[model samples]
Target chain A: MSGRGPSNYMHIGHLVIFEFVKWLQDELDAEVYIPLSDDEKYVFGKVKSLKQAYVYAIDNALDLIALGFKKGKTFFFVSTRLSEIYELSVTLSRYLTFNTVRATFGLEGEGVNSGVVFYAAVQAAHILLPTAKKGLLVLVPIAMDQDPYMRLTRDIALKAGFRKPAAIYSKYISGLTREPMSASKPETSVFLIDNEEEVRKKIWSAFTGGRPTIEEQRKLGGNPDICVVYEWLKVFVFKDLKNMNEHAYKCRSGELLCGECKRMLADALIKRLAKHKARKRQALRVIDHFFLHEVEIPSEIIKILE
Target chain B: MSGRGPSNYMHIGHLVIFEFVKWLQDELDAEVYIPLSDDEKYVFGKVKSLKQAYVYAIDNALDLIALGFKKGKTFFFVSTRLSEIYELSVTLSRYLTFNTVRATFGLEGEGVNSGVVFYAAVQAAHILLPTAKKGLLVLVPIAMDQDPYMRLTRDIALKAGFRKPAAIYSKYISGLTREPMSASKPETSVFLIDNEEEVRKKIWSAFTGGRPTIEEQRKLGGNPDICVVYEWLKVFVFKDLKNMNEHAYKCRSGELLCGECKRMLADALIKRLAKHKARKRQALRVIDHFFLHEVEIPSEIIKILE
Candidate 1:
């Protein structure tokens, strides 16, 4: 997977979804090639220096490694460092016309940069690189809004003599006001850096459709099905089915209040993301060594080219 | 300057123009950087493999070296192997909009390719490489038809924070039909590999505006200025002002017949290009090493980023 490193310092959304990457490695027995696309970071992320992007990639990769991924079992690489990857991208970009790329991305005027255009081809190449021999079932987990890029990747892959990747779409978790939660909108989502108190405060202020008065809520009952907090609890917390169903039924029958429900959800989320913070800290400590020695292109490959 | 190598053997046009490059080193006391743009060559030149292009670039560079260019004074590089050059090109491409490039190159839909678009940026970057800080006075002794590219480079330099390059345009030495000489069109130009007998035969058949009969020619003189053979002598041979003017006046006054003029020009060209044949043979000897080492980016630069 190639993209800018998560900007919100890795939240519940990152933890909940990326846990599947670990599951794929251990249970499904797949050799995961995680291309930490510092290329994307330089183009889209706030960073300007390619070196800074390289270091950030190392930090991000170490976080992934700490999630029980064996070092050799998973391959990590930066996009700019790989010549074959860039060449492949240039070739693919040649095949795709400007009109096609413009239409796909809704680009007009001067909005589209060469980096963005080449980036699409790079993304397409990434999906095909792993399955160069074909017939490999490649699964991409992405937000629903990013479906357009996946569709474009599938199209380019079909034309570039490669296998198409299947995608698993996931919805974005919204804030209390039902507004889409984004890293750009700091107040909307709880970041990994947030303390227990901050997480609790954010959850308490979250918008819910529950009644203001206890008497009114008892008569009408709360609709937990459409509640953002309830959805978060189901998606991020309550791994056991029995516990999840009990909470759902209690909320629908007005047996539980909104305040109590938020408290329970926030506590579970805080516990779930607590380990990543320690792991991130540890990853930062050994980052220099990883950046210098571990992330280097294989010497054998360099010798062969030489 | 990275490009796929030439598919066909080098022609007189290639040899004659490159000779001026040697002159730049011999007379001007300048540092030379030759980039074998294999990436551009792959897209434009009809070569089978990128490796083949690399081999061709090495061969060509060695030929230039054999022409008496000092090793350390003149550097050789390939486009695909130099990521820093490509990175700079990519950055410069951003500053240049698609419309500006398209308009500058007079590119229509048929001529527009990703390679062509990126190549302009690469060429622009080549003229501005930081190593060229000694004031880039690029003496491009190309055909007048290629003046647009030099004009574009000059314009780009005005906007870009880099030194502008100067160009020296040479008129095309065309074939019997007044068509621009090209290796692709075998009848249009002589190849370095062409035999002496074949060279004589081509010169005999070459076009000239002379009277059909010698008696008529004495009455109505030939237009030596329009004759391809005479132009070749003036451009390639007869460099002295007195000799060139004497030849031109004699032909115009019908003192020298068209057949005699063709014979003299052919003999001079054959003698002049003889040195290149030996250099070409030597160039092939070290071609492998040239391809292997010429274009690779320095490890020190990569280390700096790390």
Candidate 2:
């Protein structure tokens, strides 16, 4: 349970991942550690300063908490607050050679900053947080694009005599434009923080699989395969197989209009966003309940100060 | 007043630099900071673990304190012990881009680990430590090899709206074999921690400008220009120009034999080492006297963690 600090508001894509993590935690009956890398946000130039990243981290953490993860079991830590993470990061970095990280991150022969190169270790520290107390069966729930980071962490953990964490990768949720959902381009994403009005506006302008005219749509059935709304329904909005099947059938038969489908999505999202906003407000009050202190400092690290 | 943690013992080369720093502090009536980058030593593969490097840092600090620096004015900090330094290090790291640092350090397309890459930022933090309180004239007494780091620090500091530090470069004291003294290769350097026996042995085998045969050296004068002993005398032992001139004349005229000169150096070093040992013992008793707490955290950084 780790993510780089958000410089912008998180989109629905992040919400999907957080929901998945909560499910995994419940299934495995395991503790969750969420390390917010605010330092990385500044170091990587994603934010103007650490203060901005810190605000993002707090805002993002509130969103995660709003998803209703177990309070005592789930712990969130900011990278800047815990110096031990950086120390451990330095330790974990030793297991990875420059050549290996360069190749792994596709930075070979490229001008990657030292902070970016070193970020792998900090990320690895978050993944191996469970190993500090004692080795445990670990599972990293992440998106497919994060597979490389998981692989690197597994390699370093194994080398350091810790259990290698298993990864379960989820498919990416596409933007309304049929591209990857990104927070940087706010217009492309339906953010969890957006109000009902904003959600409806975005959905109204969203790309769809409808024909130019009603007669044309009736003659040539809509192609749900190319529809962002249909993809979103399959991945997140519509979880019931029977309901999803009916929606797909209606689209193929030209019985379901694109406007109606978009309106349905907007309504569902508006209700969901309202619920999320209330929970987020509650989460802000009890955010400290899930905060974690410094991890157990290793004896080797203790010896350093002595 | 900052140097990377010593993986091995402090050589005479380091002693020269420390003496110069002490001189500057006395002349300027200023505070001194000595940051031992134990984290970097491990990151750069100079030591096996942070523990090893930490021990080395302590030993090196003892050596510096033994040089009789003002107890209250001189501050020593290890990278692992100080969280504030890590925070400042992360802040400074952002000002440098990958292209600039890589080009400056000649790490472009090279296999340099993240620890090594990030180390430059930590080094820069030490350089800019004075800026935390108020802008003041800063003089970094460093060897010529470290000029690149100073330049990088200056560039970053100026951009960050801090006073640029001034650097005064020192000529390196060569190894007994007439090469640059390095802690990695113990045999090449006469360490401050070396015992009388080891000192005698190294000096006995030291490279000199003496001829192969004593009879040949009497006919053809010995070249003090290439003599390690003459260099040592000029730099450390015989500070007086008149005494150095006489020693050089004696060497050039073949009046002083290499063996006698070696014995003289050995005796001088043995006495100096003994004095250093006593002060080191005293330094260990009051190590806490020179320990520095976190420098005043800037409002910008405070806001980050707030």
Candidate 3:
């Protein structure tokens, strides 16, 4: 249940996931431990210095706290402080052989770095951290591409005598180019810090299949199914069944145009994520308190305990 | 400078190397950090349980403390508590490729375990942990067979951007059968707990190159160079150079017989190692103190801090 630091502005991908985690805490009676995975950012991210990584991790942690996660329900910690987890990682690595890891990852010849290979074991150890033995069902919601790592983790868990984790696979949110949205490519995705104008311009320039001429549109019909902007609406907004169905059918019939669809989806997305952004601002200001202090064990959790 | 647990009695091989470490500390002004590597013992050694390893590590730590390591000057800690070092080990491993490690250690396919490969990085990390910014000149005194690991560690240090370690290699002391003495082979090695009578009996049963008759030995000289008992005297006893050279030539010239040579070497070895055995006895009683505290940066260390 750990999150990475928001070194770059919090993008739509992060917002969607954190919101889902928050929903799980409120409805599913889950006791969540959110680790700010600053260590990963330090090693993988573009931050050239350790000091920069620390600052970036702190900034990202603030953004996460602002996303309205209840202090009592969530336990937030930085990865650097948890040395016990690293020791456990070494123990886990010792039990797994190199051939087994290579087969699991599909790595061939010299393509894999030792860091990437051992990183799978480190991730597996994270799931079995002492805090994870709370007897609650563990659920990890990550992008579909990251499934290989989670699958490897499940295999390692069986050997280590720990329970396997259940996962929720979410599809990637695409960018203006209709390619997978990456935080590194800021222009393609809307960040939490993006203002109203930037959000509008990105949507306006977004790749769509609709034509300008009425004859061409009628002949071809706008393929709303292939449009990245339309998919964004389905994932982020227009959750109502009747409204979504009507929009999809109308767009396919050439009754609705690309410009109209883009503007409507943009408006809905901004409205849907606005509350989270405001909270993110507040979270950043008081981050020191949230990260350093232990929160109360919620009454609901205690009742389940009793 | 991590020490092994003392609950299991140390053999002569352990004594020889430990004595060398003591000499280095006295003459080289070395600041020794002894990690009671109980975690390693639990994972790899005969101890099947963590509880056993914990107890054993404590016992051994006390034994090492009694060997005259200054309390403030020499720091001792358990491997489990020193998570920072383990984390650094993981980081160091990333910089080292498998090819480089395999080449350095002369490991072939299936020849190396993941732990064995990772341990070299851990050993390198151990040498660098005390000083992060500045380099250090580490000296490791071990048996000749262990030279490969030290050599690998030195190469890893160069690649990992740390200080190189210098090694002082000592040859193994052979058993009564003229084979390398091993703790696993108890009859061949005299433990610290061995009584005087047992020591005398073992020496008496020891193999020698002595002839059947003194008359035959006077004409045909004993092979002092090939004799295990004679070599023990040259390596472990007879500190005075003049007397040792005189005895070596005399033995070769048929001046000293094998029976007399065994008694003299055994007496010198027993007398020389007497203090270590006494200290080991006192160590076993107070082994509890070694595991009582955590490793902290001492004031003196901080004064010359990285």
Scored against the true structure, residue B129 in model 3 reaches a CA lDDT of: 61
Per-residue alpha-carbon lDDT of candidate 1 for residues B210-264, written as tens digits (9 for 90 to 100)? 8899998888788877788887777778869899899888887889898898888
Enumerate the chain B TM-scores of all models: 0.80, 0.91, 0.77
Instruction: List, residue by residue over A45-124, the lDDT tens digit for candidate 1.
Output: 34665666565565456556557654555556566665556566655665566566667778666344445555666677
The candidate, 1 or 2, that scores higher on lDDT is 2
Q: What is the interface root-mean-square deviation of candidate 3? A: 3.6
Candidate closer to the true structure by DockQ (higher is better), 1 or 3: 1
Q: What is the TM-score of each candidate against the true structure?
A: 0.77, 0.77, 0.76
List, residue by residue over B13-87, the lDDT tens digit for candidate 3: 566666677777888777776665544554443555444555555545544666676545566666555656655
Superposed by TM-score, candidate 2 places the C-alpha of residue B164 at a distance from the truth, in angstroms, of: 3.3
Candidate 3's docking class is incorrect
User: How many clashes (backbone atoms < 3 Å, residues ≥3 apart in a chain or on different chains) does model 3 have?
Assistant: 4
- Judge candidate 1 against the unseen true structure and give its global Cα lDDT, from 0 to 1: 0.64
